[model samples]
Target: MTTPLPEQAKSIIKCCRNGQLAQLKELLSEGIDFQLFDSPLFAPLNTALKHGRWQIVRYLFKENNLPLNKKTPPIIAAAQYSKDNTTGLEIVFAHTGNTEAVDTQDRTALMTAALLGHEKKLTYLIKNATNVNATDHSGMSAFLDAVVNQSLKNCDTLLKNGADPHQITAQGDNAMTLLLQNSTPNPRLIKKLLQQQLDLNHKNNHGHTSLSISQSKHPKIYKVLQAHIEAEKQMELPIFAPSNPIEVAIQPEKNTIKQRPLNEEKTPTKSYSETADDRSSNQLQDTQSKQLSVELSSWFQAATSGNLGLLNKLKIQGLTVDEVDSKGCTALIHAAGSGNRAVASFLIQNQADIEHRSHNGSTALSSAIISNSKSVVDLLIKKQANPAAIGPGKYPYITLAAAQWNAGIVSILADAGAPVNTLDPSQLNLYHNVMLAAEYYSNIIKAKDTVRVIHHLGLDINQTDKEGNTPLHILCGAHKEKAYNADDSQIANLTHELLKLGALSNLTNKKGFTALQYAKKHHLLNTKGVIYSFMS
Candidate 1:
């Protein structure tokens, strides 16, 4: 009885998956079928690329010469898988010219690489597979992805790989058009992309061409592109020339209007008056230099004026509202801490982002809490401030705010569903601080307001501090063995008040002793009696 052969295409795909080059070769020698999975096309290659099996990919491509699908290659899968195991990306592309697949999101493997600034993967794909002229479904191309992701190295690689600069987004928006649309455009990147060609009249889906778009969003980049576009137009000959010599002769005056020169040269030839003007200009420049420009860069500024008019002007000028200041605070951060409702309201109205953190990881809402301003805290929450924003001190920003004692602020933060009992990474609870505050204030009245507020809010009355002394333990030891004045009675009354409010009697102090042990150690017979009676 003869053994029937396995299906040839399945066998080849299996060999590719298993890296069985020798068996694959033997089967190929026997005239086995290659297109068994050809209905979807490149399924074997796709699987091999996904797993990043380089040897198998090399075998399928170099040895078997499998057809490489230019439109729907498996490069995206390869890039995604390569995040964990990066060895296969180079091998597959070197072996197969199949990196051209633009995925459903209009994102290609090259675009992904460029977007993340994956220089090696981008270099390999640009060199081996992807066509530079292709734009994704969203009108974004790999070049635009590079700009958005701030991958200058990827841009250089694409440009070196013969990527055409004239490729535009679906809306006819080219890289230059996008550069000008950004509030702050990178001039160097724009110049590099425009080296190939500039499509002046090419309008995107919005009916606005590169020139018009540049003119509106970013004037700095616009000036550069406008000059370049006009120069190109000037160098080209007129398309429609008058046919007759008589007609041409008659049109001289109309054609000679003073069109502005594309590139005007500045020559510095100084006369006496000019020298005086230059000195005056120098003084003005020096004066301007002495005056700190309120327009801080997107990341760092100073909080000098409490006025938010500067913030308003900044937003109008397209500065990031969440720009961190010198102290790592944003406009909203200063506004919150300053308790200036007007400034905070202005920033909120102008779309100031509420969820940004300062250098210390504190948000505007957190700053408001430290300032103890209930109004600021309320405004921030209404603007959807993130309760989880940790401050530079590494706890909830609200934990550091000033008006933290304000009942309304407490309710507002508590109602926002903020984690009330969040412990630090070191397992330190918020109750630890409460215990420490008890130690700072010997007078019951001094600590009564906050304690009462926290207690009423249902904070754990039995929670122990690092020294293992709970609130009850601290209250028992507030006065030592010496006899007290009438104020001593108030301390005793406060203790009874707290106990009635659910303070636990059995919690121990640092020495593993209960409140009774602490009272007995200090020889306070009256206090010991009260604590022991409570324990009983």
Candidate 2:
């Protein structure tokens, strides 16, 4: 607002702000400089773009070769706000070299597109941007921004394109903690961090432990951490016990041995006192336990590898399909996790437990999501996979998928009548799918484009959460979140879309502030402008 506009640029700004297409055309005909770079906030070209005078934007682009500005780069602005104007953005991109221009928040154009779930711009920027790992003021890279935005594919793209997964935030949040904080800490995502050997032990300011930060909600992830701990524990003992307590190997009575003291002399020996018979018996028991472990372990291997022949042979040999491995993964769970639909179907036909939880509290349904196999997921949901049911049910998996705003699996679950109106552990209802995504959209998003694939329970566009936040209030940052506020630029664009969807602007939230009032209180000029335009 402090940026000054030239007298001629003022007339151009007025024409654009008022949507005066004819006047804007006349002004353009006079060969007046459209390169108003001095005051980016009040630049006539940017003003027209901001007000969404697309007819004027398109006309100007077609008729003139406008010079780019470092402060108010056309490509940056178009990528941030004008999502629908793809053609205009392409034209601007061709003329702009300022892809790395950071906003006041220190987020580059790439970061903004990544955070907004702007698929096209994100893809383009990932390939063209000089530094995908560039951090903002908060030490959050574009890859981190993409994770906060919750686009699994985009996160994958960034990671593959050399984005640093090891980067930590100002609050000491690493990749693992950020994913956990977003409430979508699925094992598949956590696996990537583990594979990179990223830190899971560092505590943020929240006073939570390595796994506690993740809410330790993901049982499979505990195994990732626990597996290492268990390995270290083995080094401390002669032979460590295996994890699966389900199959206890019965052993003959044997003499208990005690550690013997070793002399300090050069010829000292360390030994445990036990009868020869006892040692022999212990060896036999060890052999039996290893055999049992191997037999059970093969079941998981077979399930994961789609070895139908081995599975059928085991079934004929009287091994139950419900037999579990050390990790508590039944054959069905292994099959589902690996997306072996044929094997999953075979196990299910053989009466495999549909909701059987592994030792880590994971299930076939969650495993399917980890595989990203929509077909497997759809098949389980059709067989009555309860998403809200806890006690090792689907709640963890549901929370794992909480931030997947536009995932097709979400729609599949919704279509199958997943109990979305019910609250999850976070006290969020179905729309957390959208709300979680919006949480990272700091000054970004193409409202309808982002929310179009989302399914609302009973089509209640104005339904309130436990916090009494209607979608409008939440979209306008009327919720109780303290870490980040909704971006004013995003709120404006999203406000217009929500209004189109019949969001009630007059409705007050738990704190008694309507979306517009909340915007005004927060000094969200763009949000106010959009609401005012809608009202008018």
Candidate 3:
């Protein structure tokens, strides 16, 4: 690599940053580097165009010959800051047909416009023969972008121009499914797409059809599609007239009119409950026993979202409170995992197990701890959950959780008089737990207090594990920068506390390395010097 003239580079960068087109042109003519600002940090012309300084952008794009694509340029800027009707979009698309110009994400201008909801630009580009179906490297099509933006009109325009309705995105969502999966309601767009004959039955990557996604949120859309499907089937039936078609038509008119008047629509109006009963009867007979269970799963999912009213209604309908799902989780597990105290209390009051374990051998208590649910922890502890229970699956250890510095739950366990010195099934003890915590929490405040707590609880200060490494050895073996700034005063104070608690620090591991040797090599000058200073 060649070294650039520092002063010249500085002046050129300043010109670009300031959008001084005249100065930039003069500097370029004077042999200033044009591509010098190509670092991933910021592209010079990209910054200039982003600020709407078209003059400077033209200088860079035309004279200096800087690459306009592959960086945050005017297009992304317009999408973010420009109003929908602004000319910022026009300037962006002008640079689009340049085969030499590439987008920041290597997407075409059409994709960027659609994805970012630059509707005017998108409309112009698509009309001018910019590919409406262009996909980015991530497989996000222009139509998919419009769907993400919830831009119904833009979607209609693209679809009208032959945007592919069947194109599944990288996430395996076709346009029809993507619209329904949005958390927001887009009924107008759903109606429009249904009118275009896009399949509502098309399943996404998750094996859920558009109808399934809309089932709870947009039931109206579901009804419309279901009706359309039924209508399409009816249309496919043969429409032949009878052999005496004229005679039949003449004979039926009077009787049909007179009978219809006498019957006055005949069928009794069904109440909501009656209609529900009839539907449930048909549903039960169609699929004996399994559909009710699946419906229960849907209710449990609603419970997972903390819909207590829905849970109560389902329970009233005779859905079991203790029903285990496919993953062997109940509403209690979901509530505990989420730390939703209200839902947990509701389940507990309803006699759901507070100590239930899932398929992976994780109990509600374990899930609560992992989720950092302090309230759930308190509740479980109050309900007398066994604090000493260890996960039975692979890597079973109560101490593994301490590595994440899960302070509140650990404090709860410690308060419940659980044995702190309880080793893992592999025989590692609380010191190993503190060491792991310190390694990860080296950057957090009061992290050293954790080590002190372990020591105060009657653990060996220099305890060696099966591999023969002590906590200090592990701390010293960290990255050089980490070792340098590891707050040796904290370690000294911890050592003093250990000594006060009648623990030893001169222990050696299997490889015969002491904390002192490791500290010296890692440039932990403060810690090593303190050790010697204390000894002397």
lDDT computed for candidate 1? 0.57
Clashing pairs in 2: none
TM-score of model number 3: 0.45
lDDT (Cα) of model 3: 0.59
Best by TM-score: 3
Q: Write the per-residue lDDT of candidate 3 for residues 215-279, one digit (tens) a residue.
A: 87778777887776643332121111111111101000000000001112445888887888878
Note the Cα lDDT for every prediction shown. Answer: 0.57, 0.62, 0.59
- Score every model by TM-score: 0.39, 0.43, 0.45
Candidate 3, position 105, lDDT: 60
Which stretches in model 3 have alpha-carbon errors above 4 Å? 1-147, 150-168, 171-300, 392-401, 441-443, 478-505, 520-536
Off by over 4 Å in 1: 1-289, 294-320, 401-404, 440-459, 465-467, 474-496, 516-536
User: How should the candidates be ordered by lDDT, best one leading?
Assistant: 2, 3, 1
